[model samples]
Target: MTATRQLEGKIAWITGGGSGIGAATARALAEAGAHAVVSGRRAAELDRVAADIRAQGGQADTLPLDVADAGAVADAGAQIAATHGAVDILVASAGINVPNRAFAELDTASWDRIVAVNLSGVMYAVSAVLPGMRTAGDGLVVIVSSWVGRHAVKLGGPAYNATKHGLVALGHSLNMEECANGIRACVVMPGEVATDILAKRAAPPPPEELARLLDPSDVARMIRAVCEMPARACVNEILISPAWNRNFIAPGEAAPRPARAAT
Candidate 1:
């Protein structure tokens, strides 16, 4: 937590809040005095996150949802508006990947699934909250993109890379059109982080390599900073990675791959 309650009395809505960066961000925001409304597909996991926040003396609520469902996401947004009045901060962190990510193995079903959750899902979530933000004339959107969002990486696959890249354009376009309304949109592109999403990777990193990757909390802190900034300032984008970035290593010099069979 920060020394001051910068986000006190704020209403923050986080998608994919059941775990990973979303869960971490919820905790961080709640600690900073924001009432966090967490939304995800897992009810049990959402409950767990909310309970932990309450235990820590922070405000939190869970709204089970599947971002890929436009109607569901819109309903969730409406529910939040009815219950909380408005969402001051929107963190679009819901995302997914598959082990069969490479083009050679990528099937249409896999591609569609990833697009639904990664690309279309983000669009739905943003559209759901944009109206409220426009009405209030004050809003902050923090989009959790990926390292591949800015730089194309073969490991991330065509579907994942395309969707992540779309997020960048979406954020920029949001700012271009909504900045005058006092709404700020930021695209946070983080490198490989030690999160559950790694389980979907074709070659999951070994323990030693995972140890050096950025933790969920690390990315959460960066998000908190973006939220803490004054309403007058809008951080357009953030590209962050661990000091030991595997992406920077020379070809064929990668870390040892995990022994487990690919999912």
Candidate 2:
């Protein structure tokens, strides 16, 4: 772990832990003294992260999972619990923004993929662990949403925006309904940060806009605050924007870049 581990003894499961934000968060949590299990569809990537944690004398495990596959999400949670004894926190970061075409040009398959991974995937992860958290009477869940969730961006594809918007509602409902049950749910809506999600969208940001995105660590810092806070304190939401990203990229220069992945 790091010189000071804030989450020591806690157990956390992060979906979409194969790259970008997910990867950074996993390492950060490990450094903070938490036993973290990172999940993604890539076993090799997850295994590499696990080894890094091992080198630091922190606990970490790998689970290759397709978050869009409900069965896999459920099985991953159960496997994590079976190995770790308990799960005190969850980070639902698995998401996708692909085929950056306007709604008119977008085909059904493209839209479905975006919704499946960006919205349904998060739902699957949350549903898998909530029952156990309810039984335990305590837990924290962090949903990594986006600025598009709050305001639609005509510059980006509609399918991506829609899922993010839905995530806001999900986080809100979870917080309101589970508050009394000792389960805290929060959502984060961050502006662009550097990562490979742009690649998956089969696009890239306009070159001029590349310099102002937020960093992956910035989001990790927010999660660190939430997970380490006193049980009685909860940060309901976080909206992070780049200090210099005041303007949106114009359409036609290139496809817009997506936020960092949970990797």
Candidate 3:
């Protein structure tokens, strides 16, 4: 017998679903029986993902809009609710980072752009869907944060670190306020996932190195696991890292190992 699809008939709205972790998660959710609505700024990319999902016999639709535009996000949310009767899940994964820029070197415009999309954009999406969630009496929200939020990493710019750190706090506050209303919130902190974002790095990793990094599909599986959990339980946060931590070693240097296993 086949396992029952846990999210059958549920509606999932994922921002940044055009690519990276968001796109992977959308596909996973669709496979699990949710009607996945993917939204992103790239119309072509969004259409590609949606089309792929449909080809795989999954339910999907695409919405093209910039998350940085609050009005547009709100309008899209309203339209989704009107058409789909309120989204049952929301995965906020839209993010960007400027590489090789420190606090002293980063410009005001770049900082503003990062904050607009990574921080305020998350808040905007949350604002858009909360009313419907409140009306429905239950919902799930997954915030795709970064390990930089919990620990400082020099490679990620100050703006990226600051906004991601803020997202962790945002997730907690959201749960604190909405738990009574049956809104479950989770923050996923991923370390060095191999995705297009890496292309923005000052020195992009070669294909061989990128191959060792965590796949977006890995994170997508985690998202599905969190969503499939019983309503009585909610995983508040998770940190996922690739076993081979590229950042832990310098280029062309051999990784050190312990002489013996410690208890």
Candidate 4:
């Protein structure tokens, strides 16, 4: 079968599917012929993504809820599985990063919230969907981590780094345990991307700098590529970024490189 039909009739559940990488992945999966079920805290945004998929002649649905709420996350997965069949694909893209702060300046509340959403939320979603996948003996999971996941950085803050790092470990462990059941898992560590999340940064980068970052669609395409792979193979991890490397430089501190003339 062609890539377009690889996921025909499959059900894909994506958290934070209202925008950014989540929204882009939803579109990508839908186009590949899967029924995209998007979940997020924002009802309006989720509806918008669903509507966009439908407009393009693809299947789509919306579920609005906070991933940080463990009970709610589990319930949503259960309900979705019952109503639409087991989720053939689960993209745990819901995450948050507060403004960067020094370790001494970090407050307990901020750290708790980040861990709750980024770490607990991921585990909750995975646990909720794993049963169905195991019983069916097949599934794919894509966790959207970050470049900060594998390394320490001043701008990522302690909470962000810790949570992202946890996700990497979680994905690896999940892949190892579930491979026998025909379930595959991949952790995507992305560099700076142009998305609304940047607005939450302690100091948002300038427009020019942000423009140099990777586009969410780029990551979405990678997700599609992974999902389309033959069941015999699995992608364990991927690190994607723009051709220009700007993540090493702190936001607003680096000047844009001048464009070169065409040969």
Backbone clashes in each candidate structure, one number apiece? 0, 10, 0, 0
Residue by residue across 1-263, what tens digits does model 3's lDDT show? 13357999999999999999999999999988899999999999999999988888889999888999999999999999989989899999999988756877899989999999999999999999999999888999999999898887988888999999999999999999999999999999999999999999888888877888899999999999998988778899999998888767777754456589677
Error of 2 at 252 (Å): 14
Q: Which 10 consecutive positions of candidate 1 have the poorest summed lDDT? A: 249-258
Give the per-residue lDDT of model 4 (tens digit) for 1-263: 13465789899999999999999999999999999999999999999999999988899999899999999998999899889989899999998887755698789998999999899999999999999999999999999999888766678888999999999999999988999999999999998889999999878977887888999999999999999998888899998877776756554566656899899
C-alpha local distance difference test of each model = 0.94, 0.83, 0.91, 0.90
Q: Judge candidate 4 at residue 39 and give its lDDT.
A: 96
lDDT of residue 217 for candidate 2 = 79
Clash pairs, model 4 backbone? none
Measured by lDDT, the strongest candidate is 1
lDDT of 2 by residue, 70-123 (tens): 898888888877877658989988888766568778888989888988999999
Taking all chains together, the TM-score of candidate 2 against the true structure is 0.90
Error of 1 at 46 (Å): 0.7
Candidate 3 global TM-score:
0.94
Q: Which regions of candidate 3 deviate over 4 angstroms? A: 1-4, 254-263
Stretches of candidate 2 off by over 4 Å are: 201-203, 206-208, 246-263
lDDT of 3: 0.91
Task: List the candidate numbers ranked by lDDT, top first.
Answer: 1, 3, 4, 2
lDDT of 1 by residue, 1-263 (tens): 44467899999999999999999999999999999999999999999999999998899999999999999999999999999988999999999999998989999999999999988988998898889999999999999999999999999999999999999999999999999999999999999999999977878988878898999999999999999999999999999998879998775555655699878
